[model samples]
Target chain A: MTVETLLLVAAALFGIGVYGALSQQSFVMIMMGLELMLSGAILATGTLWAMAAGGTPKGQLLAIVLVTVMAVEMAIGFALVVNVYRIRKADITEKLKTLRG
Target chain B: MTDVLFWIMSGISVLSAWRVFRTDSMVRAAYWLMVSFAAVAVILVLLSAEFLGLVLLLMLAGEMTIMAVFMVMFMMNPAGLNPMTMVHQHRAAIAAGVLSFLGLGAVGVFGRFPAGVSFATRDVTARLGMELLNDSMLIFQTAGVTLLATMIGALAIASRRGRYGLADEDSIEPAVENSQNAGEGPPSTEKGSA
Candidate 1:
């Protein structure tokens, strides 16, 4: 398949991820949505890399870095979630109504 | 052959992503997300990005496992046992998502891209590393430092016991022992009583 087709798929995945992040109440599900968005970004970068002049490796490298960043992001984010659960005893984002102001 | 593989991987990735958000339990959702990432990794491999595909698999698998463990340890709900409803404020989100997808797809399909180029060499991984290191080794080092900071920060935040505190001081064992001792009559009080 062409790079354009891959870009289209990535765009679709990104859109779905954004929808999940905005609509889902569960914190873990929201994180899952964010992961989907990152996955789309990785695909788009890889496709661009494959299409670049002189077959640029920069895009692939960037994708590698992004995968690492996503891992670290998930680690820290879940750590924070654990701390929040300890204090609040709830995992649902909607239940964080204490900050509704 | 390549086209068929691409279609299959794409379908698997998208379906698993949908499953991630649709599942009621957080642990199940995390596992579904892992499956989605694995499918995407396969797609990356098909694109000849072998290094990136393997890295994606390793990173996402580790992440999903950690998330599942955190859910069991900290979330108020029982570990994968409690039933939940996965409801959402979905109308606006659905509209926005659909519109964005249509807009992007239209752009991708209609936009003019550079002329097609044939692959001259097969060592894509080596080419990728050379190009990456040549252009911006500084940025690569910076990313490494950022990851280090994340690791340290996560440990700082998640570690329950400080240097001075006892681990499990408030655990169930002490409470259960106290209750059992109370039931068995206060440790033979008649030894000192007249």
Candidate 2:
């Protein structure tokens, strides 16, 4: 309800995202973790925009940029995943011990 | 009423996000993430960002579906037919998660923040559109171009064949198809000139 409350929730979400990103072995799952982290960031920025920044469109614009970054990350992440799977038959991060080829 | 709705939506967001990694099935994990984002979208709506909130919901629907499909396609046990733990560094990760939460929560609770309120007399969506076209036009255009480039790059990377040759196969020139050049090595003209 309050700004602090929203920020707390965003922080919690970000923390969960960190845990997931560090723990997950699959590249896809790792990307999911990254997405979660961005989700938290977006929430925090949106909260600031709505409450602290006087609902300025600039804050919203920043949120939009973050979303765009998410999209680009997902697209390229999946593309590299497919490429890795094709080249080395790898989906797990451990399988990729070397970046060669 | 708004306060109650905010609490519920935030609770849903957090719980579903937690469930994203907890779930065994990859597709379930992806959808749980979708649910989490959707809840956050609702919270955004509660915060008076009607356009951004709705747009978030719309985008997540498609994005999460692609995530689910990719998980199924690329993962071995996509459906979680058998129990498998696909994680490492569990203790360290937990510690990091806790530490980050504590650190950020401290900031949220203790930090001094500005108290400016958005007393918008105009519609929020209309204002956003105006901002997009006026000051943020360059940023908007850049994002569009970036998305277009990402689409092309992803397609090129994911495709089995490229301009040169099949990915699995070394960059072998396509055998010359013309009768004069039949069975001959690739011409010196250029590659992919089959």
Candidate 3:
């Protein structure tokens, strides 16, 4: 596929993810949406690495780092979620207004 | 032919990604996310980044499995048998989504990109490892430290222990001596509701 096609797909995915994150009240759902957005970004970067830069390992390294960080972020997010669920017995984001001043 | 395959994979990726949020079951959503990432991995492989593509597939599959387990353990409605909806401001969200997509699509299609040349090479994984250890060692070290801190911080925050090594007073699980009274050996491993 062309670079434009890749970017377009990434853009669409990220847009959908934004919608998901904004509309959903569940924390896990929000994280899933965020993950989808990041996947789109990773795909676009990989495409650029392959097409624009002649598929160099340097660009791929960035993709690797992004993927690794995403995994770690999700793990920590879920751990926090579980602890919250343990105490609150709820995962709805809107109901979590305790921090609201 | 390869172009056709790319289109198909892209379709799968985008559609499955949207399905991730549209689905009822969180487990199903996580699996859909995995499928979407797998399609992207195939696209990367098609683009000649084979090692990165494979790593993406392997890491995402394992991560999604853990996510599925956590979804069931923590979510209130794991089976999704009950009708549930937790959405808000969906109309506004849809409008924003459409606007953002159009803006990005316009930029991608009409923007002037840098005129760059392509290089001819293979065996990129070995070159990547060499460069990472030699030239990019700092980035690698930072990533290592970040991962280590994440592990430690997550465990410390989630643990039921306090700063003074005392167990949490609110913990529901029985003490070691009283564990026999709690009984029943931690239930079945069979998937889905009891």
Candidate 4:
């Protein structure tokens, strides 16, 4: 696939994720949306790197780092959600209005 | 042939990702997200980043399963057996999604990207490790420390209270024997609070 195709897919996924993140009430669902956004970006980046000079390990390293970030972000997100649920007895965005102030 | 495979995988990833929010149940949402990630992994492998793609497939599967466990532990509907709707500002979200897609498509079509294709990646993982250890060790160390801090913070926030969790019900009654009321929602003992 060409770079344009990769980026187009990335943008579409990112858009879907933006919608989900904005519209979803549940924390976990929002996290899923964010993951989708990252997935798209990763695809574009990996494709770009792969299509370029494949002699160096820089591209692979970047992918590894991004994946690590994804894992860590997901872990932290779940932990935060669980903590909130523990305290508030709720997970809906509307119910989390106390944090707004 | 590769283009056909690319389109198929991209379609799968995008559709599954969209389904993640459309699904009524949390477990189904997680599974759909997992499928989306799995498809992305396939695309990454197709792009020649085999190691990263395979790792993502494995990790996302395990993580999504754990997320489902969390869903079962906390959500009112674990199996998605019940149809439940929990969303806000649906029309605005749809509009935003469509707009982004249009804008991005425009950019993709108009923008000039530097292009070339080199296909070497067999020993990339070994070289990646060497580079990390020898040249970019500082970055690796910093990330490791940050991850360590994240683990400690999560433990402090979620685990300090105890393995059973310090429910308000426990504080109020102090006699309830329930640890994980996963089969139910909001806990029966705390119904009065809601």
Chain B TM-score, one value per candidate, order as shown: 0.73, 0.82, 0.78, 0.76
Predicted model with the maximum TM-score: 2
Candidate 4, residue A7: lDDT: 77
Question: Which order, best to worst by lDDT?
Answer: 2, 3, 4, 1
Candidates, ranked, TM-score: 2, 3, 4, 1
Residue by residue across B51-165, what tens digits does model 1's lDDT show? 8889888777768887777656655563446666555778987887778778777766776767476542579878767766777787778888888999899877667775767
| Candidate 3: CAPRI quality band | acceptable
The CAPRI-style docking tier of model 4 reads medium
lDDT of 4 by residue, A1-101 (tens): 87788778888888998898878877877777788778877776787677754536676667667777887888888887776776666676766655421
Candidate 4: segments with Cα more than 4 A from true spot: A52-55, B160-194
Among the numbered candidates, top lDDT falls to 2
Q: Which 10-residue window of candidate 4 chain B scores lowest in summed lDDT?
A: B171-180
Single out the weakest 10-residue window by summed lDDT for candidate 2 chain B. B171-180
Query: Evaluated against the true chain A, what TM-score does chain A of model 2 have?
Result: 0.98
- In order of appearance, the predictions have TM-scores of 0.81, 0.89, 0.85, 0.83
> Model 1 chain B, poorest ten-residue lDDT window?
B167-176
For candidate 2, write residues B1-194 as lDDT tens digits: 99999999999999999999988899999999999999999998888788888999999899999999999998998998898899999999999988998998898888878975754434888899999999999999999999999999999888898777787785322222333365565666766665
The number of the candidate with the highest DockQ is 4
- Model 3 lDDT at residue A86: 61
Of the true interface contacts, each candidate retains a share of 0.52, 0.72, 0.57, 0.64
Question: All candidates: CA RMSD in angstroms?
Answer: 8.4, 8.4, 9.7, 7.0
